[model samples]
Structure formats: structure tokens, C-alpha cells
Target chain A: MFFLSPFELKGDIDSVFERDPAARSILEVLLCYPGLHALILHRFAHRLYLARIPLIPRLISHGTRFITGIEIHPGAKIGKKFFIDHGMGSVIGETTEIGDNVTMYQGVTLGGTGKHSGKRHPTLGDNVVVGANATILGPVHIGAGSRIGAGSVVVRDVPHDSTIVGVPGRVVRHKGEKTYDVSLEHGKLFDPIESLNAKLEQKMAHLENRVAELEKEKRRSA
Target chain B: MFFLSPFELKGDIDSVFERDPAARSILEVLLCYPGLHALILHRFAHRLYLARIPLIPRLISHGTRFITGIEIHPGAKIGKKFFIDHGMGSVIGETTEIGDNVTMYQGVTLGGTGKHSGKRHPTLGDNVVVGANATILGPVHIGAGSRIGAGSVVVRDVPHDSTIVGVPGRVVRHKGEKTYDVSLEHGKLFDPIESLNAKLEQKMAHLENRVAELEKEKRRSA
Candidate 1:
């Protein structure tokens, strides 16, 4: 029930309309807005989690994710200046600690390795940028001022002030990456099945190439 | 968000103190207070969904479920007199059409078979009773006056006035079988791993019996 009345929503809407650069009109947003609903519910549920109520708080968080497709775990500790854009299927795990000035796009999973039981999941240092659907699995640490590229599956710890990209998220840059507040909003909300299909296609292609190479060696041996 | 006003909540608390059964003074329901939150949110979101503002409606529904354990889909057409008990991981598919006087318990999924493209999912007629974790997949029709048992996985069309039970659900009772509307709330939400473990246990027991029979046959032959 985290929805405010039109009277109370007046101030919030006005602020968004006045400050947020992306908005053109309030009517448009009122007419068609999904993010607004998610953001508001998350805020309340997150507050309840902070209050330390058992079962009900967790249930509320669970309910929010199920309806909105934005998965923010009740136990995750997020610091100041955190923003999520088109945040569907973005899973932030329990025992994960997020530092100040961090921005994340859709499908980002700060997950733990499945087998281990207690106090698993990542610890993100200040000013980290996690891109779309990037999976930072295991109890790893991503240091301050690091940029994780889209679709990266990072298993290891990242050093401070580094840029990571591609599958397995290789470091692309290590320039002076300062901690700054930035909001991410764009095409990250679209269908993730496309990216999944692409990964499968690439794997199939690699397997085919290996098969071809093996056939060529057989022919030479013959 | 859709949280109660502090003032209104105070009144509710006062009423509970003054009256024996103010709203929810029952010991069982008081212990499981979160169910009330879930039920209310589902009605609101479902109402919004019926209004045809698709995205926001779904977002609200998701947000509600995220906070609660209940999981009701936005597009699923639920009728009046519909009751949900311990509504956790209860995935009603996009095109599911439920009728009046229908009730379901936790983990019930009116799901689709495969990648359903057109007219996907089942259509449950009026006065139907679906139990816990019962997956009624495909575009099948469960006729009016039917009772689908707990943990049933129905794929085919069910006739009117019948009772179905077990995996690949078979009609265990003929017409005129009494329907039970006794609501039960299990503490645990629908955990897939837990369900898998239960199934595995049953399968293993069956395998052990088969092995024992095989050993006995071999001994007799010798």
C-alpha cells in the first residue's frame, strides 16, 4: 500500500517535474508510469526492514519484487545516493553491503554462490557502477570507484578505481575514477531473454568451431 | 506507499484493545498478521489491472507481492468471492481465467505449458477449489464445481463436478464429492528446493522398494 494519495503525491510529483531533467509533463507520467510504483513501495519496505520487524518486513519486500520485478532484499545495507534505472530482475542479495554514490541498471545480481549458507553475497565499496544483468556472484568485494560493464559475470574481487567489461568482466580501464553521484536510466528495462539467447548462440558457435577443428585433425591423420 | 497512516493505525490498535474481536483478534490470525496485508494489496492491484492501465497496475501488484509472500499475476482474471490463503508463490499465469466462488491455497500455479503464444493458460470455472502448489498448466478447462487437490499437476481438460488429485492429476472422486473450504496457512512460503526434496524423498523410497523386490527375485531364482 505504499502509494500516496494524489494530494500527498502533489509535492513528490512537483519535485520530480521541477528537478528531474527527463520529465516533460506530469500528466504523461500519471498516465503511464511503472517505475513510480516500484520506487515508492521499495522505499517503504526498505524502511520497515531497517526497523527490524521479523517475517512481515521480509514478506513485504518479497511481495514488492513479485509485483514490480525489482528485487531488493530486505537485509541488504545500501548507503547514501543509490539509484536504480528500469530496475526489473535486479537482485540485491542478503548480507550485501553497498557503499555511497552507487548506480545500478536492470538485471544486476549481487548474488552469492549457492552452496555456502550464512553471510554470503558481495560487499560493494563506494562509487561503483554495475551495468545491465552483470552478475557479481560469490562473497567477493568490488572496491571503490569501479565500473562494471554490461553482461559481466564477475567471480573475483575487483580493485579500487577500475573499469570492467565483457563476459568474466575483464578490467578495461584503471584511470582516476572518482566517487560521484550518478543516476542510470535507459534501455536496461527491455527483454533479458535476448541477451540470454545471444550467450547460448555464442556457446553453440564455439562448440561447433571446436568440432570442426577436431574433424580437420582427423582428416589429416587419415 | 500503501501503508496505514500512523493516526489510523493508532485507532485500529485502540479498537483491538477495547474489543475482543476488533478486526483480527483471533490467536491464529494474530500470529499470522501479514496475510491481511497481502489480501488487501492483491484486491487493489487486481482492481487496477482490470482498469486497463497495464504497466503501473502490474508494478503495484509486484510491489505488493514483494513485500508479502503472495504472488498473483496482473493479467489473470480472478472472479469475486475469490479467496487466497497463505498465498505464497501462487503464480497465476498471464491468461488464466478464474471464475466466482473459487479459492486457492499457497504455491498454486495456474501456469502455461511451454512458451505459450496464444490463449495461454487454464480457465477455471466457478466454485473450484485448488489446493497448495497445484500446477494447472496448459490452456485446459476445469469445469464448474470441481476440486483440484494439493500438489496436483493438471495438464488435460477436467470435466464438470469432479475432484482431481496427484501429479499429472487424475480425477479421484466422481460428481457429488464434497468440497472443503477450510483455509490452512503453512509457515513456509513456496520454496522450490523444499518441494524438490519432498519429491526426491518419495522417488527414492519407491526406488528402494523396487531394488528390494529385484534382490528377492534374484535370490528365489538362485
Candidate 2:
């Protein structure tokens, strides 16, 4: 059974202030941030779950999901300084495990591939940042100080100090120095589709050039 | 000012019942579905927006967004028999126009490309079904009876009765018969990424065979 200490709770609130520049006051954060509300509710539900209370924990989780649109299963284990920005449609699966100082954007899903049973969800290491609409599936592990780009779908393990991007996410950058900055700019990520399209266009141009050369040779022969 | 008739309201409720097999009673739908609640609130906000009531409409929309997590700008126009399933994180931008009998799933964003001014958002024709987490961006038009697959990022216009999939969505099937089935089965849709991967694998196999044949010819010549 895991418990969040009073120091951890204060750290959570303080982390929001440190991370979000728009956070003006503690009162506003307490009242306005649905992500904070959802996390606070999740703590109670997790406590109930640790006590081996089944239905009540689930009920509390359901209520929290309804209010926040961020569904965190009571069985998911999260560490300190966990922040979810604009957490609508974010789902943390039952078997998910997270380390300290993790930041997540909206529409992120830590889910299973629908084939596994126990411990199906992914485990995140410390100082990880996940971008908007990213889906990390299966029981893979994401190592410390990694950045997952927006709209990425990761199914495999990611190494430490890596930047992951694209569908069936690929590590574009690895073994870099860990920047403790957790602020994620979603629009500035790498686009795999656009890159693929550019490659295809270049291939088409090469083929066209070859065809034109062949035509000129045929004319000379004639 | 746009007004929702009693008949339209009944149609909206009836559409939910017809689409969702889990919907047992009217009471259950009224109380349970956050999508319906958001839509109901949007109607009032839209009316107030049309009447030029300053700040009140925006306040109503803000409250609705907080409660439901479905953000519909008051200036957007929507027609009858609209149904949204698991509507959390669904965002309808201002100046967006949606036609009748439109069905949408969770996390769907009808947004702009951030380059346009007026009518920046997409316009949906009648009987369009948008799958979960599908993003339709820019001022593109989705024609009547089109089906957008789950997790697709659509930036272009779609033809009538077309089935769209992939990033920067492509129409895989077109000129199809309109079934008018609002119940969208997300798992069963065609995956363009898988298809592309399969094609690449086949090409690789062919290249390998050609290389082997060339080597055999060289050995014979030697």
C-alpha cells in the first residue's frame, strides 16, 4: 500500500505553479484546475482501493471521471509532482505505474493492447513528459528523462534521455542531457507523415527524371 | 436566433436511444450521458449568442465546458438529430457548421488550421459519423454520409459517402451506399498504416529476390 505524505501534497500544488505560467494564484488553481481536482479525488479512491474495498473505489473513480473527463484507475500507482495539463480524455489504465516529476498533456492514454491480463499497462520512469493525444500501449517501460511527442503511439520500450515520435513511436533522439523543463509545446513536434510524404515525392521525381532520359535516348536511336 | 423545436429535442433523445444499445430508458439517458447534457447546454448558449447577449453566452459555455468537458463555441451552428457518444474532450470551434443526423465519438475536434479567420472550422454535411479522437481541421467540408475512422487527422475535404482514414486523411472507399447506421464500430475500421506497412514488406521481398537472382547470374558468368 502506498501513501502520499503531506509534503508530497504540497509539492503537487507547488509543481503546478512552477510548471504552468498561467497559474496566477493558489486559490485559482484549487478552484479552477480540473486536473488538480481529479488527482485529489484519485488519492481518496486509491486509498479505498488499498484498503481492499472494491466497488466503492470504482464508484469514486467513476464519479471523478465524470467530473474531470480524466479517468485514472484507482489501481494505478503514481508518484509525487505528477501533473496533467488540460487533462480531458486522459486515461491511465489500472496497471499503470508512474515515477516522480512526470507531466502529461490532454488526451494521453496509458493503455494495454487488449491482449494482456495482469500488469498490462506501461511503467514510466522519473522526469518523463508525454504530449497531447499520445497513446502508450502494452507493458512497455519508458526510461527516465524521456519526451514523447504529440500524437505518438508507443508500444515498445524507450531508453533513458530519449525523444520519441511518430506512429508506433520511434526514438528520434537518444542519450541526450536531461533538461528538467517539463513544459511541453505540442505544435513543435516532429511529423512522421509529412516526412514520409516528402520521401515519396522525391522518389516520384527521380522516377520521372529516369523516364524522361529513356525517352530522349529512344528519340536519338530513332 | 436559432431555435430547437420540441420535435428536434425528441429526435436528439431518440437518436441516442437508437444508436446506443446500452440506453435502456429516457431517464437514464437524460441523467447519465454527459454528451446530451453538453448539447442541451450548447443550445441555450447558441441562442444567447445569436441574440447578442454579452458575456452571458460565454459564461454559459464556460460552465458547460467545465461540467461536461465538451467545449462547443456558442457561435457554431448545428442541425437536428445530433448524437455524441462519450463526448468528453470533444471541441467544436466557433463558425463551424454541422448538418443534420451527425454522430460523433469522444475526443473528436472540429478545429481550424490556425491560418484562417472567418469560417475557419470544418463544415459537416448530413448524416456524418466521426469516430473517437478523430481531428478534422481547417475549413474543409466533410460531405454527407461520410464516415471518419478513429484517430484519423483529416485536413482536406471528403466526398459524399466516403470512408476516410490515416493522418492527413485519405478516402479509401468512395461513392458508397448510405446505410444511415449511426452506431460506429471503431475497432473494425480500415487501418491505412497497416496497409502501407504490408506494401513496404512486399516491395522489400521483391527487391531481395531480384538481388539474389542478380548474384546467381554473376556467379554463372564467373
Candidate 3:
């Protein structure tokens, strides 16, 4: 029931190297990386689930959650070359759909908001990057080449090539420029609030000057 | 080596009921609630650590991490009635100090930033509430009754009764009024960004009106 060719296994291993800078060697990755372990077990469990086999798949998924601290429901559909970095406390719901070359960081959740039945979880398009602790809830479609910022809560459909940030996630960028970057560099992410604050500071300075000038003009007129 | 009086055990279990609204029964909490399990194990491990015992304490801590998905270094100091809700992916680093009646949500990290040894992790004062996915790094002090919002990354010392929010956590409210709230209601958290944006919107409107009045006055003067 559980089988993967050497080539396919190597592809999965290589996917880790593309996203994580800390990965040292194959031995270290095999021994230390819980994310890879979770994916491997998830793949096996997913096969069992697809075959309409009961209980064993769920047991395998539960055991995987215990071992890796990453919970992926067996019924979730995932594409090739997907990688989860750190991945502790990350959860993918039963009906969640993930696309190829997606990168998910630690504590991320692709979850359902309510008790609704079919397709309750989110759908991610190819080359989507979900940052640490980001929660994407409900059946939202995150378009290709999109990036969800760390700690953002997304509940809506995002268009292609978009960058989402803030709680109740807002699409801050829709450049349509495809991101080939597998490394979801969180440090460089655009903070909309900080930028807005800076603009406000400038406006305040300008307003102070204008007010002073107005006061002087009024005095001269009197 | 492992013993707790019935009264003490009841007190610990009662702490859960104080924080979590979903906690229906003590039996259910004992059966489930990884947070409580982790704390029980940590208390045992911490005693072993204090007795100048080595290896075994670390081993117990490591095993507890695997079982509960929460890591608490034995060297960390924790006080009474401390409750961790959900607590998956939560980490308490060595030299971390937590005061009485402290509440921590899921994915919270009390961590060190640099390699320097002494008191590397943050200290939480009594009644401090750390929301989900909040990362408090370095040897900072979180004053009593301070609330760190969900997804906040705090690196600095927070004053008593302060409410912190944002990526590089900022003190949004410094009210001296201490919070007795055990439930870290994340939905009600004051978003500094949203407030700033609202203020900006109002300012923009005021500027527009002022500019229009200035233009009219200039036309009348001409």
C-alpha cells in the first residue's frame, strides 16, 4: 500500500532544499525534518483514503500528527513538490486542495470556518507561499504566485500574483508579476501599516508648516 | 518522585476551566487537553531538574514535547495556576520566568533571540495573557496584566497593563487598569493598523475640505 520510487522520493527531498536555507544534508533532513516525515506519511495515508479504506488511513494520519506536530487530514488533495518548513501546529483540513510548488511555514492553518460539509477548506493555486502562523479559512481560492503574510487571517478569494497582508487579509499587491521565489522571505514583506504611519508623519509635518504660514498671513492682514 | 496532593491537582485542573470556555468536564480535560498533560510532565521534569539530576529530566522534557507538541525546558521557572490553552507548537525556553495566573494560547513562544546565555528568554509577570502565535523573544519583561495580541512578535519590555499588537509589537494601550480577563479574546484585540488607517482616512477628508476652502478664498482674493 505504501510505495514511492527512488526518483519520486528524491524529488520530495529536493523540494525541502528549495524552500529552507537551514537544511544541511540528506541525512540531517531524514533524521531531523518533521515536515518531510509528515508529507511522506500523508502521502501514504492519502492513498489509503483514495482506495476507500477505512480507519487505517485515519490512524496513520493521527500517528503522523503525533510524530510531526503537523496535521494533514487524509482526504486533503495535494499536488507535487509541496513543502512545509518547520510546520509545527500546521493543519490542513479534510477538503483542502493544494497546488504544486506551494511553500507553507510553521503554524499555518488551511481550515474550515464552520460546520459546512463539502469543500469547506481552502484551495491554493500553484506557487503559493503561506507564511508562518497564517490562517486561511473557509473555501477561499488563493490564486497562483500569491503570498500570504505571516500571522494574517485570510477568508476571501485572492486573485493571481497577489500579496496578502494584515488580519482579515487584504490584497496589498496585485502586480501580476510571477514570483519564482521558493524561499518565502518574511523579513522583506511589505508592512502596509508602517508605510501608512510614515505618510501620516509627513502629512502632519506639512500641515504644521501650512498652519504656521496661515497664522502669519492672518496677523499681517489684521 | 511524582506526587501531587488531591487539592493541588484539583487546583491545576480548575485553572483550565477558568481560561477555556469549552472545558465541560474535568474528566474530559484529563482525557484530552495536551496543555495540561504537558504542564503535568513539565512539573515532574522541573522537580528532577531542581534536584541536580540531569539526562532524565531532559529526556522527560523531550518525550513530553513529542506527546503534547509543547516544549518546556526544565530550567524555565513557572509559577502557580498557569494555564496554556490548546498549546500546540508552544515553546518555553531555558531561563524563562512565568508568574502566577498567566495564560498562553496556541503557538506562543517564549524564546531567546541571541546566543548569550543568562536569562535569555522573556519573563512574564503575574496575570499576563499571551494570545495565539505570539512570539516573545529576548530577555524582556512582560508586566502584570499585559496582553500580547495574536500573531504579535514582541522583543521589548512591556509596561504593566499594556496591550501589545503588530509584527514588531508596539504598545497600543498603556492603561494602568489591570485586566482580570483570563480568556484572551483575539477577536476583540485592538488592531493598531486599522486604527491608524481610520485616522488617516479622517485626516485625508479634513485636508480635502481645507484645500477646497483655500482654493475658494484665493479665487475671491483674485
CAPRI band for model 2: incorrect
Name the TM-score of candidate 3. Answer: 0.66
Tell me, by lDDT, which candidate is best.
3
Ten contiguous residues minimizing lDDT sum, candidate 2 chain A: A181-190
User: Comparing to the true complex, what docking class would candidate 1 get?
Assistant: incorrect
In candidate 1 the C-alpha lDDT for residue A211 amounts to 53
Report the error of model 1 at residue A91, Å. 1.0
Q: What RMSD value applies to candidate 2?
A: 7.0
| Candidate 1 C-alpha lDDT tens digits along B73-169 | 7667766556654455567777889887676655578888878478789999987777544679889999887777654579999998777754467
* DockQ of candidate 1, scored on C-alphas against the true complex (2 decimals): 0.03
Query: Model 3, A1-222: lDDT tens per residue?
Result: 466557667877999987788999999988898988999889888999899886667667767878888878788999888899989898787889999988898898786543335677799999899998997766889998889988886768999888888865678888756547533665456777678888878877877776677667667777
Candidate 1 vs 2: which has more DockQ: 2
C-alpha lDDT of residue A154 in model 1: 67
- lDDT of predicted model 2: 0.78
Clashes of each: 30, 0, 0
Find the candidate with the highest TM-score and give its number.
3
Sort by TM-score, best first: 3, 2, 1
